[model samples]
Target: MEINGVEIEDNFAEAFGIQVSRILITAATKKLALVAATEATGYGTSVIGCPAEAGIDGYVPPQDTPDGRPGYIIMICNMNKGKLDHELLERVGMCILTAATTAVFDWMDEPDEKLKTGQKLKFFGDGYEQTLDVEGRKIHSIPLMSGDFLVEAELGIKAGVAGGNFFILAENQPAGLLAADAAVDAIEAIPGAITPFPGGIVASGSKVGSNKYKFLGASTNEKMCVTLKDEVEGCEIPENVNGVYEIVIDGVNEEAVKAAMKAGIEAAVKISGIIQISAGNFGGNLGKYQIKLHELF
Candidate 1:
């Protein structure tokens, strides 16, 4: 199939099941809220190395939030339950709690499980923690030098899909980067999904394992590398295509992820110099969900 003159390869993106928690970070001002959200999601790009895969879903208006303050929605995902619990504790306690005039709330209305993150962090209040009823929801208020930091008693965790991705093949680096940026911008409008990589673009896409190093869990996807097109056997890079960028998405469910991929691909193909669009898979070895590119249409 072709879109806007760009060929769409007959392939699928393999995704895996993961647990996710959506949270709202609100603060006295929009700047503070964004700062806290960014800090909380920091160093969370890929689960292969980072403790979690996380990113800002979008910003919320003051009137729409629980605390009547400007805030940002963020989603954090992990494959392990213990690790996700610990990550939420550390991120909420150290990142959001330390930020000025910040408050955290569970954004999920219905979750598969609940983690007592705020219940655990409440001890830092040093016996001064007070439980308050806000808008029919229980909240924990912990005193700080800046003021009181409020958090929900428990955070809701739900099953989500991860590793939904697509490759943008372009004639050059500038074209590829521009297409990737456009795709990320389009995905940002989608609800219940997030592109977790830095700026929502993966410059160094990896495969399951290294070709030379056995110890590495993942290494450069040599077949897709433009620089290695001549040297790597079975190179997927098309002739005249010198740049490629991958957009990795994690969503609340399969539907959300599929919507993101569709939106991203549609926006990317509109950009000039795009050669083709393709997806990565490992012969059904990567994960259970095989999202076919053609089926998206």
Candidate 2:
């Protein structure tokens, strides 16, 4: 299939099931809220190496927030529920609680697990911590140097989808990067979805394991590398495709992930020098969901 004259490879993006915690972080202003959100989601590019995979889903207006303050929604995802709970606790406690004028609230309504993140972090307040009902929700008030930190007593975690991804092949490096930037911008508007890679773009895409390194769990996907197109056997890089970038998306559900991919691909094809769109998969050997790229249109 072709979109905006750019070829869409007949491929599918394989995605796996994972646990997710959606948190609404509010602050005195949008800038402060974004600051906390960015910090909490930092170093969360991929669960392959990182403790967790996370990103800012979107911004929440004051009128829509539980605290009536400007906030940002973030999603933290992990394969194991126990690890996801721990990640939630650590990120909120260390990142959000330390940020000035920041507060956290549960964004998921029906969660498979409820974590006492606030209850655990309240220890930072010593004996002065207090619990109160605000907006019909229980909140922990922890005293800090700037002011009292408010966190929802309980945070929710639900099963979500992860590792939804696609590739952007372009004529040159600048074109590939620009196309990736446009794709990330489109995915940012998608609710319940996030691109966790740095700036929502993956410069180095990897495969299941390393061929040379026995201890490594993942290594570069040489087949998709434009630089190795001639050197690597069975390479997927076309003759004219000199630059390639990957966009990995994680979301609350399969539908959200699919929507983000479709939006990103469509937006990317409009960029100049975009040659083709494709996806990565383990020949249907891994992941639970296989989203077809051609079917998206």
Candidate 3:
């Protein structure tokens, strides 16, 4: 199939099931909220090599927030529930509490697992912590040198799909970069979906393991490497394709992931120099949720 003249490869992006925690961080302004949210989600690119995978789901307006402040919605996903709860506690305690005028709130309703994120962090108050009701939501306040850090008592965790991805192949580096930028901008606007990589683009896509190193969990995706096309097996790089950037998406459900991928691919297809749109998968071994690229359109 072709979208806006760009060929859509008949491939699927591999996805795996994992646990996710949705938290809304509020601050005096959107700037502060985003700053705290970004710091907390740093180093959370992939679960294969990193501790967890996380990204900003979106922003919450002040009037809609419990504390009447601008908020950033962040999603942290892990392989298991125990790790998800632990990461949430550490991230919220160190990142949000240390930042000035910042607070966090649980964004999920009727979650399968409730994590005591704020209740655990309130210990920093050392018995001087207090509780309040803001807009019918319970808020826990922890005393700090700057002021009190307010957070919701609990965060909700549920099963989610991760590692959903697609490749944007272009004729040059600049074209690939532009297409990736436009795709991420469009994907970021979709709810319940997030691209965890820096700038929402993965230049160094990887396979399951390394061929040379035993300790390496993942290695370069040789098939898509244009320069190594002559030396690699199963090379998927076309002769004219010089640049390939992958967009990995994580979402609350399969539908949200499909919507984000559809928007991203459509946006990239309109950009000049985009040659083909493809996906990365391990034949469904990695995860059960395989998003077919052509099915999205």
Best by lDDT: 1
lDDT of 1 by residue, 46-130 (tens): 9999999999999999999998999999999999988999999999999999999999999985799899999999999999999
What are the root-mean-square deviations of the candidates from the true structure over C-alphas? 0.7, 0.9, 1.0
Compared with the true structure, what per-residue lDDT tens digits does model 3 show for residues 1-297?
998889999999989898888889999989999999999999999998778999999989998888889999999999888888889988988888999899888887557878888888878889999998877778888888988899888788888889888999999889999999999999989988899999799989999988899899899888988889789888898989999999999988788899999999999999999999999998877889879998887
- lDDT against the true structure, per candidate, is 0.95, 0.94, 0.90
Cα lDDT, model 2, residue 107: 93
- Residue 115's lDDT in candidate 2: 89
- True lDDT of residue 37, candidate 2: 99
- Candidate maximizing TM-score: 1
Error of 1 at 148 (Å): 0.4
Instruction: TM-score each candidate.
Output: 0.99, 0.98, 0.97
Write the number of the candidate with greater lDDT, choosing between 2 and 3. 2
Please give, for residues 68-147, the per-residue lDDT of candidate 2 as tens digits: 99999999999998898899989998899999999999998678879898889889998999998889999999999999
Q: Itemize residue pairs with steric clashes in candidate 1.
A: none
lDDT of 3: 0.90
